[model samples]
Target: MKTKHYLTLADAEILMNRAVELSAQRSFNMSISIVDEAGALLLMKRMDGATPLTAHLSLEKAKCSAMSRRPSKFYEDIIRNGQMGFLTLESVTGMLEGGEPIMYEGQLIGAMGVSGAKAFEDAEIAQKAIHDFFQQIS
Candidate 1:
């Protein structure tokens, strides 16, 4: 029988490792977090210089991404333009920064989050991780 969800143990490992590599290369130590489709923690890493606040934010962003099944940075754009509707939706949605959903076969299987640097930088690393994920499978 064909396998189920696109996510696999190997995928998880590659994603986590890529996050670490990007974090190091950027010289922005961070706390990285991943969550499954159901918004459950998968794996997390805290670099040497990551701040305590990064821990919670990392998880929050990962959770937000998983829940929204969209790049959390998109919300940043909405907020930047002063979209109060989107801001109020935050009360009902898990939207936040630093997280992005992981997709395969056009389906979301998980999300990733990184914190420590600026929100955009963290989002960049997360985006690289996601891009690398698709590359790993392709």
Candidate 2:
């Protein structure tokens, strides 16, 4: 049997903390979600001032990234490029942006998603948090 790398609760906490810090620094009160490789939610947070809908959206985005093994923005881009068929995908509900897959040593471990800011800003926050997470682990 082959060993598989997966994210633990501690890893999820690290990602959430980093995302929270970055969001605060940017004055963005958003919702954040961390999900395992299989698209199961590990942690979720909705900051003060963030809408309730953001909490749901963030989780969906994280699931999309985890299931697709790619940034959620990838689907968004495809849809923008006139690939309407992508919208029919039942597995991915969040396709706008802000979802980023977490990879370690080329292995997909989990994903992070953020919402409430602009789409690009959300994506940026997620990316930064993942980057910081990797920095800490490295």
Candidate 3:
């Protein structure tokens, strides 16, 4: 038997609302997205002033994170350190931060993405949403 896993749309929206609140407190318009276990789109939103492009890039970054099962920043580090593997990794380098895998029962269930601000800020928003949402999950 397999334990089913994926972030439901309601849960994704709950997380996104928290993200919006946090970004609003900091006055950042953001692009946010949540993808399921297969890295398929689930939910997405763009704040009032978020640029249109952020929507696309944010989703892709999240997909990259889910596919790699690691924070996007780690890849950023590898490239910044001039690792040879990164030479052909440009296609995977959204290492710009703000992407995280969603976990349930110690397994990767999905991922979240955020953009429309600094890389660190986007990362922070995604982290906060994950923390807050999971607190109510189990």
Candidate 4:
């Protein structure tokens, strides 16, 4: 038998709260999404000024990171470097940046996606939130 780690609702809430705080500090209105390792949405939030499109795109970015076990930006970079075929793959979407996989103790537990700021800024918010979440928990 093998032991596996997964995210609970409490964990998701912590991540969300931290992300919201970070966004507020930066004066960014963001749409945030969290997803399990299987790319299923667990939690989502669209801030007051975020666009409706950001809500949907945020989830897709989380799905892409969760499903691929890599940052969504990975796909975007490959595509930009001439791997246009990545666009045809149906396993993932939201290949633009801003999605970050959540890993704990070398185990991939989930992912977080943020939108509304610049693409790299969105990615920074997610990455920083996840980093802070781990620090608080650890």
Candidate 5:
């Protein structure tokens, strides 16, 4: 058997908090979701004023990222590149943006997703959390 890194509850909480802080700092109410390597939710938060749908979208985004092992944007780009058929691939969703996998020491530990503002803005918040998360763990 081989050992692998994974996100602990403490790490998930830290990532969730950082994502929330970044959203608040930018004055954007957002829903943030964190998922383990298996795409199972570990934490989720919908900030004040965020749209109701954002909560669900964020979770899907995190799951897609974790399961795909790539940023959601990667799939978006594929669809944009004339593979619109990518949408029908039921194995993934949340392909618009805002999904990011957490990597540490070359291992995929978990993933994060954010929603509420523009797609790029959502992705930015998730990226911030991923960065801060690594700092905390390192």
Candidate 6:
């Protein structure tokens, strides 16, 4: 059998809290989602005043990022460049900027997604949270 790493509940909580803290700092009511490498939802939160839709969108974004092992912006850029065919890819929805893969020890273990703000701002929260997480672990 082969070995694989996965995000624990504690790890997910740290990511969620960091993302929420970042969003709060920006005064942006946001939704955040964390997913394991297999695109399984690990934890999610929707800040007060954030739209309900943000919760669902954040989950999809997390799944996309975890499964694709790349920032959701990569797929969004492809569609923006007229590569509409990308939209037809199987199980590859949520092609937006807020989703980013989470890596540890040079391996992708999960992903994080943020919503209810500008696309770039959402991406910033996810990226910053992951950066802080890695710093803490290091």
RMSD of each: 3.0, 1.9, 1.8, 1.8, 1.8, 2.2
All models: lDDT? 0.80, 0.90, 0.83, 0.92, 0.87, 0.89
Model 1, 3-76: lDDT tens digits are 55855666777998998998899798899888888778888888898888787778878888888788887766
Q: Where does candidate 5 have its weakest 10-residue lDDT segment?
A: 84-93
Model 6 RMSD in angstroms:
2.2
Q: Candidate 3, after superposition: displacement of residue 117 in Å? A: 1.3
Error of 6 at 33 (Å): 0.4
TM agreement with the true structure for every prediction = 0.83, 0.93, 0.90, 0.94, 0.92, 0.92
Per-residue lDDT of 57-118 in model 6, one digit per residue for the tens? 88888888998899999988988888776355444458888999998767789999899999
Best by TM-score: 4
Measured on C-alpha atoms, candidate 6 has an lDDT of: 0.89
Tell me the number of clashing residue pairs for each predicted model. 0, 0, 0, 0, 0, 0
Return the TM-score for candidate 2, rounded to 2 decimals: 0.93
**What does candidate 5's lDDT look like per residue over 6-107, in tens digits?**
889998999998899989999999999999988999999999999998998898888889988999989878877887663454544577699999987788
Where model 6 places Cα greater than 4 Å from the true spot, the runs are 1-3, 86-93
Per-residue lDDT of model 4, residues 1-138, tens digit only: 868999999999999999999999999999999999998999999999999989988998999899889999998898778877534554445887999999987889999999999999999999999999989998
What TM-score would candidate 3 get against the native? 0.90
lDDT of 3 at 23: 90
Q: Between which residue pairs do clashes occur in model 6?
A: none
Clashing pairs in 1: none
Q: Could you give candidate 3's per-residue lDDT for residues 63-125 as a string of tens digits? A: 878887877777777777877362544475456588888888888888888999988888998
